[model samples]
Target: MEVRASPREYDGTFVTTQFGAENVKRAARDEYRKLIDKHDSEDVLVLTGAPTSTDAFRDTLDEVLPGATTPYVTSPVVHATDVLNQTDDRVVLSDALRRELRHRFLADYEWETEYLRQASEQPSFIEDLDRVMDTISWQNISPEETPELREITAALDAFHNWLAEHDHIERGQLIPEALDVLTGDDYNDIVDINAVLAVEFEEFFPLDRAYLDALTGDCDLVCIAEDDASVRRTWVETGAITDYVSFSESRRASGVQPSTRPAATAAYFAEETVVDDPNTGSVSVLAADSGDNQLATIANEIEELIEQEGWGYDDIAVATKQSGSTVTETIESFERSGIPTESATITGFGDDPAIRELLAVARHLAADDDNEVPDHGLELDTDRLARVGEMDQLEDAIRWWATDSGVKERIAERETSLDARSQFGNVRRAFRMAAFLDDTAFLDATWESFEEMLERAHEYASQQNQTSATDLDGGVRVDHLQAIKNTSFKTVFLINLTDSEYPGDPFLTRLFPTERVASMPDYPGVTDLSNTDVDQTFPTDSTASSRPFVQYHAEHARRCLAIGAEAATERLYCCLYEYEDTALEERAQASRFLTAAYADLPWVTDAADPKITSEQAAEEFLLSRVDNALADVRRANSQDVTISLDEVEAELGEIQELLDKSGVRGEELRKALRARVEFANGEVRR
Candidate 1:
């Protein structure tokens, strides 16, 4: 094997190099420049492991090869899918179709519907099924012995056969199918390239390896990797790429020195203060009373950063493991603080009040035999209706009731109004599904089918990115660990860093048992793979393995901070509610990573005192006055009498005094209070 090594300077040629994080960008720029200089910039294809990496590569390329056209850069899955889609012999099924198939499969089973629903909603369910179909030997298993497994296998087989019969394909089938296409004469033009560059990817799946093999046979292969000899050797052995060049010395020569501390700690604390320079950067770990308190702490810290450090909202990023209720509460807190932030994670639209209410109405209407409305406290016009009367009229009726009963108006007042509207669209979709099944036995059998359909509707909605009102130019970029990779920020707050939530619980595919999946020959074992590269296989039961990748993400900022509650008081309360009459106890621990990182540093233990901004105070004062005015008007209307103006004046005077105390005075406060009072009076009359 011939190996070509480059110095610290660009030599106008591409090479397989192992570099550190600091030098990865410079190496990519050099490689990109060489490729563009040698071949047309249009002919170069840059394959990265992540979308974030792809963006970073393009940015670096623009800097290095200025005035040149940007080359095609994409993740392997995306590139493969694009190639496979070029032919019309097969049709690719959308996510919506895959969801429908899963729904149909679950409907055939007789187990707990909740378990079935949860299994269907697993992020990797479809992908895991595809993997099984491509690798597992189904003939060896028996349906009688493992009924759930049998049903899963059969459903998968049926789906594959259906795709074959209909000349259709799913997203997971794209990579393998494209690899097969690449080996054929038809795709020669597509596969022929100047060079193939794989960056920041630790391991390759079988499909990924196959694609790389095809690419390597056609063109030059250069992998910009970390200092992992085993991974490099695996690529050479499995992918059949020959050359290896060490850029470590050059990277170090280029003034990119590794920190003396553990990479995990350096990344987690991501601050110059760790190097004994407090004036240069800031880092802190906060312990809060609850998740809400954690978010309040984050909001306070962000405000302080903006005020003291002269940092813009755009200069901050928040990373978390999951978009659960904590995320929702965090967004609400940020909104309350009047801080604009953009969530880069997909939030569940099922959490939207409008969607929940719509589904509740549908359920009530579908239960024709038991014609009783569930009391949700809100006076909905739909609740007053005796029945839907007609299946076709359900959607319109629901919409009418929602509009007339002020559900939409109430939703409009929420910060998540945009998301609610999207969920409402999903609700309409469920109704359409119901309308389509009206003539079938499914709709007539039981109301549970409609509920299942609504659940499916929610699942689909949850897969989409929720709306966050943000300015186009800048706002705080709030996202998960994965999304924030390859991006830098001045200040970063990694929230929900509890033991189970930070690195997150190790993912085990529900389609197969963990032990069996790990034992499979082709399955990427936990031992050798990086967390990001640990493809559908179960991860190792070690925090060391899991926490490193998260730490890497944390280190992407100049100043990284984290917050975790020491004990979950909220979970204890939930336990109390669950075991109403029985004795129950629950306890929680903060993430071990947090404890380790902050053991030697000063820890901030206080829950941020909820700051009442002048805007908030003024709004509250006006609302209090409006509530009093509304109460007086309602009382007067009920008694068939008029309230004295003096009582109203007194309430207004109290509000004015409160606003004055909060430093909200002059014409602005007066106009706000007057508008609120007028609005309240009009609402009362209506």
Candidate 2:
């Protein structure tokens, strides 16, 4: 990027920034001089072609070393493009491509009420029933004596009955419906099913079918019966059955399973061995603890590096496997620590208003030319934008993208095909062509439109809703993965890095054909088994005993490891909990080479520090700051002529009251009083 003239004699050095090139011509000359043994100033050749790295190379040599020879080569070719023709060679979509992909993500939305209505009429209605069971052992309290308690009890009974009767019902659908019914009518005595549904609505209710099905189908309800005999009797009477059964009296029955509970919630902490002076330096582990408390340790280290080593916050990064909770916690903690961290932390959210607005403008420009809105036309007005910033209007724009027709149209034009396209043929070609050869004018127009839109959004947010709190920089930007990567940190704690998550499930990933039968050993012909008086399950084809060449798990692991490794730095930390740890470890190993070669940092395992919280330290720190501020104020006030003795006395009384309330009274109070007196005396003299 740098350009300057070179010295008379060809040398590797250029007269600019340490790594800067003289002029393009001089750089070319220098390159040639380095390439050739001796450079004749009069015998230089010049070449030029498309505006690329090649052009820069040629121009640099021609200008710097005048006699340098260069050959101009042109074959009507642009920059080299890596065409992903083979399926194996293809890379996952980039964020931009992903955003485009999202538009094509067939939105098959099914409402809860509607789905229930349609499914209610199906055969095997009771198949959906959870179970019907009545416990004979009841509290001796009379229903008349405790009506409210009785009502609640009765409601639970009714709920249990409904569950048993409708055992065939989708638990996912039934649970929501049951909750809705419970919360709706107090007549039943339990919190209405409808009301309970409302409480957990967002958790189960999803925007897409995949989300809904995944939530519903993947989990099973675990019922623990206090009396198994009673449960079986009730189920038999109600025509309800279970997939499995156990009773204490039966020979097949097993006793209650032993609890596998660790002595402490923090078993890892318990396993830690503390070291003294020689190993006083902090230990580095996988940071497997995903909780906020664990992240606090990592954040504390970063803070230590900043304060002790004098490194900027930007110099260190906090990377997590995915842009999720750990990232959010770390960034929020950083800001809470009074550090002005930038919009780089990959908290699972969206982008900064400034950047988002720019991107919106860019995306708009990248799409089409004719749909320019007034908002997109204006040049960026910093002051006006600042006022908008004050109001925190980015939320409005995000909301618009989520809902508004115009914005949706712009997005759709840039991304989705105007036809019901399959993953083949003309659609793919159209997408590629549109992406590569997008109209320049349209892109410019879109940008201008977005700018104008942002201004309007800001104005509305600020002027109309001043009283209401809008986003004022608390939440972290999460829109783009690259942006997320840019803001990621050193200690990355990835959760849910399981087979069902990373490569996703077979159904979701659609990696293999849905109709493909799961490969299993096929039994061989055993016509002579009678003669041997035995049955054989061996397959005729020995090769059939081996699994088909399906490499789903290995493939998924490779991809996941590749991504994690690519994102990790020298001090990378991969954290997963016991629930997910085994699978994650099996799936991928910690990134190889660096940390092991350099040094080993213990992961500071320990008994959970007796919860003598840093909260207490934080409180003391805050009080100290307040005291310092008070000292400065008193010193200034004593020298000022703006107040009377009455004002001084009032301020003193207030300070004393505050001190008493805070329990920081005594010597500190005396010192403050003396300082105030000295300040007053100085003021009087002045």
Best by TM-score, which number?
Answer: 1
lDDT of 1: 0.49
Each model's TM-score? 0.59, 0.27
lDDT (CA) for every model shown?
A: 0.49, 0.29
**Which runs of model 1 end up more than 4 angstroms from their true locations?**
1-21, 65-71, 89-91, 109-155, 189-193, 227-255, 258-279, 307-312, 322-341, 352-454, 459-475, 499-590, 599-686
lDDT of 2 by residue, 67-96 (tens): 444433111111011111111122323222
Candidate 1 Cα deviation (angstroms), residue 537: 15
How much is 506 displaced in model 1, in angstroms?
Answer: 4.6
RMSD of 2: 28.0
Decoy 2 TM-score against native: 0.27
Residue 147 of model 2: what lDDT? 30
